[model samples]
Target: MLPIALVVAMCLGAQASLFLALTSSQDRMALAGEHELASTALREEQDSLLRLLKDYAFWDSAYQRLSLRLDTAFADENLGLYLAPAHGLDYSFVLDGQDRTIYATRGTAKTTQTALTALGAPVVRAVSAVRRIGPGGDPRVVGFTLVEGHLALFGVSAILPSPDSKMRERPGPRALMILVDYVDAGMMHELANRYRLADLRLTGARPGSSANLPVTLYGGEVAGHLTWSPYQPGTNARHQLLPWMLAVGLVVIFLAIVAVRMGRASARELIASEAKARHLAHHDTLTLLPNRRAFMERLKLREESEQAGILYLDLDGFKEVNDVFGHGAGDALLKAATERLQSIVSWRGILARIGGDEFAVLITGPLAREGAECLAQAVVQAFDEPFETAGHNLSVGTSIGVVFDNGDLSGEEMVRRADIAMYVAKSEGKHRYRAYDPSMERGRELTKQLESDLHRAIGTDQIYVLFQPVVNAGDGRTIGVEALARWRHPDRGEISPDIFIPIAEKSGLIVALGRQILREACQHTRSTGLDLAVNLSPAQFWNDNLFEDITSILEETEFPTHRLELEITENYLLRRPEAAAQVLNRLRRIGIRVALDDFGTGYASVAYLKRFKMDKLKLDRSFVERIANDSEAASVASAMIALGQALNLNIAAEGVETEDQARALRIAGCTHLQGWLFGRPQASSTLMAEIPLSRRA
Candidate 1:
């Protein structure tokens, strides 16, 4: 149909075009495949080799042997190494973090000297790069420290075999090794993706194989991969391509792309995890407020001013609520109360719940006192509205103790003072608040001082006994005296029993002091020939053998038991009614007269007056002090006296300071009186000379 020459030309053109197109397509497919396979194969080879390298990294034979020889933890216990084989580079050595060579066994092993420069020669320098190495530069060392002579933290670099060495040096031991110790969740994800395992993704992307990636699996950038003989198989990929005549790369490239992406995601996750951990450490898990540690840090800064206050708020009846409504209701109530406190004190103070049902607010500036008071009031008022819990109406109270720069106190000290104030409020009556009193502070300080002094006092025998004369009150006849202890301080002069008596009670030194005083009084009885009266406390009465101790003293001293009088409070009788009755009866049987001291002041009702066998009733000074002002007080006194007489009990009025008061009591049928008007509390030796009451009686 056409010319022969034109047909020939068309045939040649078509044949050439077909040949060129086939070549171009084959080249592109081969290129894509090889690039992918090379990347994946390189990664797979690297990973397998890395795993083998890890085996050597944890080579217990070497690291454990070294640690046992050093007889210490030398480093983090796990000596680490890293090998970067993909970039025609590898380094290996024992690293003391920072890529600083703790020891080295690269091609050039060190036998002796170890300046970091020589020890960290090849692998070490690369691992210690300050910033991550460039796409193709050698590794470098960055951060390292020998902390407290204990641990050499290795945060910066990975030390491994030489970069120049080829991989497969030991079966599958690649030249690159990394510390698995720091491999976090993200890093584990990276490792999982590197193998092209299922659910293994890179850069949040799904991958068919290592087909079209520009980089490899290692965190560092990789421009190339060297896969030698003994190539591993790479099939069963989700996506596969036909093999080119001269290429095996598509799958590898696909895998590599996935690996790079996975590494990045892992990095991002690691950062997020670190941030969350730091935040949690400073915050309270329950309230989401700054915790005690964080609060202390803030308080430490304010301590420099010494001009701060604290509000110690304690839920007064929280325990009762817990007992009645269950802990769940209590917890809900606490949460509600905390919210109330939070709302009130948020602007002017730092509030924290340092203890269970005990919250505190630290204050700065002059407003500390005012702000603390305001916050404390709000906390008290918060519970005024009854809460419904478990179908029951629940009510609670708070006792707030406020300290407004009362004195410079530590955080613990502030807490203590606030606690004391809270206790004071509770003691006075709950649902109330109190400011820190200077007297209370002084009392605590003095008590601490007394505690210290008491330890020395017994050893040095600084306490000595003094006797005060007790009289018949009627005939002014001299009776045996009361024994008292005087503290002869080395520098501060005398401390009275009133000051140290409470100290002794709180410190449990009362028993010891009582013993010393008793021994001293008996020693006096051994010398005197008259009646002796000793005051006993409720605490002392807990010892059932108190009468025995007294009898043993009297029998040993050959002193008449009838000449001794034992005085106790009605409060003590109320505590141990049956025991008190028995002990009093026993003392009377032994011919020792018993006197009820401070009788009307305690729970000494008319029923008790008749319940216990008694010989005498001693009127408390409170009633005696008001005799001149209040006729009702005198009537109370007369009622007590009449009750005593009705029970056939001798009546004694104490604190009779004036002759007029004594005359009034006598008119009211009181036969005995003891006061300064009669005689001061002078030493027994002085009283023996000043009063001639025995002859007058």
Candidate 2:
């Protein structure tokens, strides 16, 4: 018994010693990681400055202006007060061919204009080093510098003379230099916050401190040091160490008890975390409903259950909500919709937000089919009341498809069939419900095939453009042509734009389609001198670089922008009015004519007419068709024409299929006309020869 007691005592001492050693090693490793992280952050900042310098130095404009040595105005406009503050740069310098500073500005505000004579010795050294490397060689020179009592990271690069020999008529050597922000107390604190280090500061070297990283400048000179120390407890060292000593003593007294409790607690925590993860994986976060995975699981579990029905529901016009009111509003609308749906489903039905605006429900009971249909009707009725989301009173409709279990169908099969029915309900008319029918499968197959073929068509040379002539109402002479994109599926023949345009929009292919159409139109009409009008989709506006796209097309085709007219619908403006207005303003400034197409078909507020600069308004065919008989339609057409005249805007009557309709439109004071009467949409080659080139107002 005495020998056993002595061995146990020796084991406890050895274990305590091992714990202390491990704790010290962990502390050292943690400190090393913090120091390494700080150094990386500093190096990343240096890299960022080098990238900015390269972007400015390698540019064609910089090359031309710097080589000439006569463009101080270039520096004044770009490197003055705005550039430094906007880009978080400290100093901007444009050096001439002979490594002479042509323009230099320092500080965040450019208030301190830096001259070559006043340049700091450290900065001059960096510039001289980059010059020695020569322009058209290395792109960047990075180093630290001690300037104005602060250590700053400096980057310098030689500006390559333009590859266009025309710009280098007179030049020697050219380069650009920039001084990044200096590392001060505020910058050090910022770095500490980013790296989560404590009490980071610049300090003299500590011989054995692993937390010290050396800062080197040009010519391998030591600029300064970046150093940090470990975080300390708020209390005295004695108080901080007291708890640890007590813990060690307790560990020695109840070693087995402490180990058992810790192991159990860790096991319990791990079990709880894994359970939460599994629940989250199967549940929708937004609606707290079963997700697709969970829904499928439930369906599989209840496959043999009697009288089960699966109802698949999709919200119609949901995309419009996202496009018009934004994704936040869409989310809010979905949440509100789920609550309404929940009330109808109650506790008996399993409701899930499958994805997006789609929802699925699994119902079981003797009257499951009837209950499902009733619930679907209730959902349809619920949407009749407008949804108030973020001050936008939006309206949406639900199309539901219900499929009752036939005792043989799997859950996935039932859901797929129900989805097919839902699409059919949507196609027939939204805000309705339909029970799954086998006949619907054929149409679904066709849709899938069409989508697949469309993908193939887009990848190949199957899509083409045609032009439709817009003629004067009185003389029946073509004045302008509207370009129309057409798709000729190799096996299916000519596909209507109406049928494929929506597909393109849904598939996110509209932007590429619009770009191709624009390019084709510009190329076709470049020399024809006929005013060219191209319809622009609302989706096209989402491309923030659309202005650059138009500019590039014009430059490439050399098409006269003044003769190119872009027609957009009022819905496009309503979706994103400010963005549309900005785009229109840019287009108008560049000599492009903007026109409102399908004018009466959308939200026609005269306020939009006043806000947007439009060259013309094309009267929709609905009003034109009604003008032949409906007095109200005739009055609206006359009113629209008068409004256009009052605004000094051109009004064009479209879809004029009959002589009577054309006559009525002409009598109503519409200045221009387009449709079947004018000419069907045809190849540009055919229409170009028909319209004479010589015409003026």
Candidate 3:
């Protein structure tokens, strides 16, 4: 018995020593992993700053303003409190060719520069070194610098010129600088919070430290030390392990003692792990909501019961936010929107973000049409206020498409119908909700077909320009003609601009279509010597070749610019005031008259009207249609005409389908009228008599 006891004791000691060693090694490895993770996070943060700096530096506006040595306005708008606080930027600056600072912001807040001497001598040398490389080639400089005894990540990028700048001449190379806080207590705390570290610290390396990490740059310059201690085992865990070690002797003495039960616990643990895996597979990571697969699964199960309601939500003006503020800001806004939606939808239904800006909610209860509409309105109203995110106040809207699912249809079909309804809501005007109806499907299919056909019709002879006479309202004489685009599909006959123009605009094909129409109109009406008005799409504002294209077409056809009128919608002008103003000014310089089409239908202010200096305003058909019946409508039309006269602008009324409407408009002081009553839009060949055959090329 003594020899057996001695053998058991030896075995027990070996087991305890082995367990402790394993625990110690695990702790060491975990500490090492934390250090590596922190290092990687810091590097990623630095990279993000560099990317943002590069984006700002390579912009045309920055290039132009910095090269001209003017950055006050740019700084006020871009490098202000919003950009820095939203992006967590500590410092940013634009420098001219002479290495002089144009503007600078610091501390996640834009502040007036008190002095440059506070940057310390080391930073000054670093900035000088970056400037010596000269701007252009997009040279990027990133490193850690000791500024005023604080370690900071600094980056510099040369400003590159934009190929499509509105500026007549390209600017010379300039540089932009950026800095982010690093190796500070606040920064360390932030990292700890993000990484869930218990003891993350930035301090000097001590003797016998468990882990010592050096923050270094590309040139291998050590900036600071990141030191951390290993996590210790819990007291309860140590006590538990001690009891198990003490039992090892008894277990070795009796073989049955070592064969304790574990199968049931293991089985339960395995089942829980599997359940967690399944849940993760069905949910979205970013929003932590059900993914498409999970939503479809839920939808399938719900369909086994009675009817269900589906609300499809699409964000409006989301693309603009992404275009202006980068994807990070977009992501922040999406998360914010998701939170708002969650507050409204908790315990009521399943909400999921199926696409970038698309979300869906499945309601599994009996809901009347009115109830569904109220819910949708509530959702719309939730986004009425601007979302404050990343230090910027951004405005966005939601268009909800609602549909009730009958037992006859599948989950995908209900979602599709809701999508169709949502698109209709967007088409009418965003920030509203629409219910699904059977008629919307047919319209959707027709729009899809038209979009498909328009692509093929652009280069073919099927698409052509038509001329509708703009007649003098006082008499029956034709004064000028408005050129309109008409598409004749191989199988579907003539498609009106009203139907296809919106599709073209949505599909981003309007630029090409507009150019084609302009070329055709110019070619057909150059010799007429009568004024030719052609509508311009808002998409043309972003087209770099717009001015060149119009000028080249005019020169090719020898079309007199003085006799050409380019009509633009008020909505487009209001959306891009500055850019549109520049385009209009350039066209005026080329002797082309500009007109505001559908003037009162959009946000028309006297200030914008004056800024554009357009030569004509066209009264929308809504006012014209109601002028004969509604006194308020008549007064508005008369007021518009009077406004046009006061501004010394010619006024034309569109959509005059009857003599009553025409007479009303004429009496209201409208100078011209164009509609079916005057003449249906006809082919340029057929309008020769109205415009005169001598004017045909």
Candidate 4:
């Protein structure tokens, strides 16, 4: 009995020590993870604030209103009321080139202070730092500072023109925009909720007994400390096991063997849980694929001297599918896509779902480039077949961008270049792959410039309407005019519609630009008494306010609805046939005639022609251009014109550059001819003057 008692005592002590050690180790890991999470959350908040500030500071409209024009109304509308509660911003200020405060807002109210006197030297210091960077440099400063004895996050940026603005060349001291948000109780509460911490708060001084993280400025000055109740996983576990432990101690000899087995089982479960947690951290839950962090880490592991190939893929039309169907269907589609990609990339590369509808492939070692290209092609072809999900056959494609490491690029840069190439592929057309080239970077910069400039062009004189006469076939008399949008870029001269139109569409500027063009066209031709035809972009047509905006524009310009015609392409109609039918019916109800522009370019069947109730069909330029040169083209064009006539739709042949083409189309039952043959697209004033001449000719 003495020997058993001694053995039991030793065993119990050893087990207690082992269990305490395990729990302590787990607690330490949990604490370390919590600390990292807290730090990351703070950094992310700063980044978000900086991004928000840059968004307003580097805007053309903000520059124009605050720096160039000094429009206070604009300041009050945007920098004042808009930035307050919506963004959790506590203070907003705009300073001129001379360091004079031109605008100031405290919360949602405009302040009379012409200077940031309340903010003291911190504002001046931040502004000076930003100015030191200058317009050519980073031109932004963001940090934490104490404002009126309270901790706050602040961002200061030089109010410079957008990347595409011509004003970038203007010589002067640039203005500055300042935004501030306080680190108040609400923010602390939010952090607590996010990180699952307790009693999170900011303290001017370090607390004697609490888990605290120091908030440091850019200059390494400790402004304050964030205090939180640290999670004590070990203590909690010890408490939970204490009752059972006491019971085991009471029957030590009897339950010794049972307790050992249970201890082993518990240890296994804890290890398994830890393994699962690690996997969850690095993988996407939906597809069980490696996530963005895992992908980046793996890419970073490649040697700088090693050659590698990276492929960035973005799923096309996934958002539309997700919207029209449901997330369940989208998830199923993604899973199926993952399987297909896995098959193509089997044993060749690492595949990861970086984000929503975006995936990345990394290939290294010999023949990496060749393998990547083949994999990309296979991936593109794999998506050609419709995916079966949620009782629906969903058709979607992928645009892949492939880049090979030149032994000089970093992993992040390789990924960036691959992403850019993918965007280029999607822009040119989806369902294709593009190899990265040096020129693509330049093209991307130019595209960014264009997107920025295009925003300023709308509602300004830079964007205007050009009228191209639609002449009656056989007689050469101008019966109607089509309004085309033209952009006269300040520096680049005449920017083609083909270039900027797609940019506008891609950037979601199409709806506004389309409305502007429509209003301008109606206003320009309100006195011409000729039929006015305007084109509608897919974005404009799908806009919820399309009918309202169009009718409002017509009413504002006093343009007759019966004489106004809106042209839509067949591709858009084909995508959403039911929705298109409904929108078309709405447009026709308002007595607006809708024409099918660029007809015969796509697979528009007779059923679509009758179903869509189009008033006119504009024969595609490709068909019209080839009609006079090719026999088959002529037969096809003639058949299209006859089909239009049979459907009681006016047939307009576009791109009629030669008399032969015009005569061919006229003989083939074309009612209207529009192209360089009759009249090139001209300014509204110039076209109005030539209207009588066109009638007489």
Candidate 5:
């Protein structure tokens, strides 16, 4: 009987020990889950705040009124009043390019105090960090800060123009918009309830008895601690099991069995959670499509099959949809686009969203190239119908680049080639697909080299401005000279403007190049008494500092603004009619002349011509070349000139090579004629030398 009792006691003790160990393990797992949940909740809150700030900051109206114009009324009406009670924001501030507060709001009321004054050095640090990152950075920041000794969450974002804005690519200083939310009783209670955290509160120091999360500031300084009562399942379970253990030894055996089942259930839950995390990591959150990582992984694992193909696609005019509508609409459009792509791709390919408005497809098996082309064509056709999203019918197109594996290339190389082709397709014109070619790669390399060279050539003698004489239509005498940029490559000889000019524009080097050309032309013609015409790229024209840059150049060269004629294309005018009108009016106010160049090539209508109020209309060369042979072309050219004449605008015919074309233009009421016939684009020195002789003629 004694031996049996001792054995029974040993069994009971072992059961109790096993029970305690299992409960303790479960408790640790529970605590880990709670910590992760709390961390994720904090991160989610930060992301939500950032999204709100982005919605406001990346807007045309916000950029224009707050950053560009600093309209206080607009800020109060649109931004300030919407904060506080509506959005639960404590304060909102708009800082100018110089980090000075241009607008501020406390709750729903406008405040005189700046972000720096209200929030202290933290605001300055955040702004400085964002500026340091510049255009390449995330452009938005969210972090914690101690405002008035209270823990607060803040988000700072650069005031950037919407994707559809004409000033999207125009480089300049950016204003910052800041939104602050304080951690008060109500916010703590909401967080506690949302995260299932008990007694969650912000404290100045870490609590010994509670689970604490450090509230880090923008610069990584620990501002405060968020403490919460930890739920200990192990301790609770042990207390409940202790009474059973003391009452009956058999209860320990039953509790141990229960604990074993609970442990197995917890293990299964953990495995499922891990699987969910993996799925999320591999898939896009919006479309649930395999993301870039998954696509690349599959690509790398692809067999060396001759029939494999890749297609890279980019959405054309999607930015306009985002800018005009909103991000919500943009997201809906993306999902719609994904659905359309999936319908086309079906089971033939693996589709993934690689970047913003960019997608990739991988296909294998027989006739992969043909299949890719078919898929590409279908994808392009799918977007032909406008997508109805957010109660708005938005039209967007896609450019696709297709590549077939040669069995020698890696997956990354194939994707890269496809990307290059896609860009080429976009450059040629959107809503089309281009197959990857060996020559295209060579051309891409050459373009990169040229872009690098062009950067170094600006403001140097390697890049010089040449002048093409604009002659009187009847007498053929030089009246004004239009400045044309020319580049003399050191090794490759003279690089055509047709090649380098586009490169400069694409690289944002056109701003500096345009300025240099303007200065040189003004300096050369300051004493020549010749009206100076200089073409402004869409980039240079839309530059925020355009007026100031032009004024400074004119002043530095002592060139009269009245004698300056800036030529803009029809394309630029169609981009933002209202904004272009304002810019044109401002130029006219300062005694500068604006001309509509390459007329009749774009979507400029009669109303646009009248509304823009330009000084001249330059007929595109297509009309001139066709006018000599095609009577229909001559009539159109004549009518265009007649319209310009009725508007009291000068009509300049460009690319006049023959006397017949010249006579046709002259009879059609063209005031100015420019072509090789008048003398091809020459150096400023050549024009200067001919000035006296031209005057003699």
Candidate 6:
């Protein structure tokens, strides 16, 4: 009994010692790993700094001063100011092959010079090695030996920030150089101060010693990865805190044993609880299918990664089902329909209630888009049968938007594209599926970005108007200025108008943009007293109170209404003739001019123009392009000019890109012609300052 008791005591003591030793070793290892990470960070910073230096031109006075050995103004004032910020023990020296300090910073002990000596080791070997490598050589460690008379030590890579576009001047590389020591705590602090976390110690096994100890790292280049260290923790270090480690180890062992025993039971309980809660959260009370949130989440996840299928199924004539059968009967029918859907998909796909009488099925993994469409067809076919609910037979129809995943799209973007396709399907007269087009995706990005920019356009103060002068065709005199929107993005630089205009229109932000432009044009006219012409889209007619907005802007700016002309395409009249006529009439009533643009390209119904008063007719560029080479086109232009004459409209032939084309237009009796021939769009002020060339006038 005494022997057994003694054996049990001995085993416990051995286990406790082993546990404490292991804990202490782990702590030291952790510290080493942290220090290693710092080294890597410094290395990365150095690489970035090198890139900056190579990309930009930089000149440093320090090297020149050291070479000349001159204690001059540039060295004293500029070089001193540059090096002063470094504030480290590092001293700059002119290295000569003869091993002499031609010029050394204030701290050179007489005994510091020696062959392969620690102090001279970095100065001699580092500089010589770096100079041999030159640029594009290794970045590990570089220096120019005094043998070459130049080289500087770049501190740990982490101390460097991102490079600048242009280097105004070189402040030279900063280093906490201890030519004698490997690297001390003070140098570590200096580096860490310059670059965050550069001083943090890392846990690692020490080299050639069976004990973990603190290591001060000089730079990432020299750290050489402590991870490869072969030495392990000594026994004493591992077992330093025996009893405490034993307690922790024992508690961990007990918990791990219990966890293994009840693992399956715990997992089953957790899954069941989560499933029940999720079921309740996402399902409708009576039908017990998924709700809108589930549908949206599923749709979102599907679009962001995997290729999946979304069936936006809307029950056609479900309103009549409720009206005739009553709400209780309708509820029963819904439940029956949900049951049918469940039986078809089982746990394979998500069935969700979108809204009143609207349902969606989002399926993923091994589910084909074709298969989903087939299911939709089956659903339609099944619903053809009488759904008996509340002792009554009811029939309903459905229209589904079949959206197939393209890949890597946002949930909202997918839904929107699908919705658009679905609308087209519905317009074609419902009861079918439509595949989303990849072509739409190609055009969507720029449009979306433009829409975003336009929405934040006013607040970001990113939108600015650049005015181009409109010159008179008669005498080439500046007539008016046209304002165009320009985007100066913070990161992307300049974004063109061609990219964003359509986007703004699609997002309905065009209305706001147009209003802003109108206000700007009016204000500019008031300021410069220049006549201005602005373009308007067909969508502008939607604003029933546009005339009111225009009048208010004119009043505020106190700009003459006669000086502001608005131009819209001939297609605008074809879009909504009645609305366009009313808007034109209102503008005319306000003493403002309206120009019919892109004429002879649309439904050029001469009778249509008589419906509302127009001040000018802009010949479509296509017609103008053809007139230069074709007599037939010349006749058409002649006819259009004649029509404008009889209608008392100012005829403008656009796209006169040559002197001959301008001459022909003027000969054809066109009063105004705008083209590159008459000086391409110049800044408003430049136009104001130019003297017009006399020709047609």
Per-model TM-score versus the true fold: 0.44, 0.49, 0.53, 0.61, 0.56, 0.38
lDDT of 3 by residue, 1-697 (tens): 8897788777766755655554454455455556655665576566666667656765655665565456565565666555666566667766666656667777545555522354544456556666567433336677676666777777766666442222223355445554544557777777666554566776644426666578764456676676665444322234554665565556542422222222233334434544544554566556777877778888888645476788899999887777656678889999999999999887777899776688998887666345566778899999998899977888899999999865777998988888889988988778999999999877767676777789889978998888888887776677678988888888988887777888787665788898888888888877665579988786675566789989988988888889889888876665557877888899899799998888786546788788888799999888988999899999998998999898899999899899888888888899888999978888766787655444322
Pick the winner on TM-score between candidates 4 and 5: 4
For 468-545, candidate 2 gives per-residue lDDT tens digits of 888777777677888998999888898888777866665546777888889888998787767889988866865666
Ranking by TM-score: 4, 5, 3, 2, 1, 6
lDDT string, candidate 4, 124-229, tens digits:
6777777777445878888887777888888888876665443443578878888888999999998777556688899888888447788986556898888788
Q: Give the poorly placed runs of model 5, Cα more than 4 Å off.
A: 1-306, 316-355, 370-399, 406-413, 424-452, 472-477, 506-508, 542-545, 555-558, 570-583, 600-612, 622-646, 657-670, 685-697
Local distance difference test scores for all models: 0.56, 0.73, 0.72, 0.82, 0.82, 0.56
lDDT of 5: 0.82
**Cα RMSD of predicted structure 5:** 11.1
Per TM-score, the best of the predicted structures is 4
Cα lDDT for residue 77, candidate 1: 25
lDDT of 5 by residue, 1-697 (tens): 7887788789888877787787777667666766765676677578779878877898866876788779776687667876687578999999988888988888998789879778867777888878877664678888888788888899899987663223442467788999999988888898788667799888887778547788888777888787888766666767766687768875656767766676676656655554554565567767889988799999888766566899999999887666555678899999999998898889999999986789999998878878998988888888899888788777889999899985778888888889889988886768999999999878777787888888888878998878888888878777889998889988998998878887776666788999998999898888877889999998788777899999999999999999999999876776566778888999999899999999986556788888888899999999999897899999999999999999999999999999899998999999999998878888878877866764622
Decide which is better by TM-score, 5 or 6: 5
Candidate 1 at 24: error in angstroms?
66
Residue 580 in model 1: lDDT? 77
Q: Give the Cα error of residue 460 in candidate 2, in Å.
A: 6.6
Ranking by lDDT: 5, 4, 2, 3, 6, 1
Clashes in model 3: which pairs? 86-390, 528-695
Which tens-of-lDDT digit does each residue in 350-428 have in candidate 1?
8776646777788888666777777677777876877665565666787888876644667766767777887667656
What are the runs in model 6 whose C-alpha is more than 4 Å off? 1-446, 459-461, 527-530, 691-697
Q: Give the TM-score (vs. native) of candidate 2.
A: 0.49
**What TM-score does candidate 4 get on C-alpha atoms?**
0.61
Worst 10 residues of 4 by lDDT: 161-170
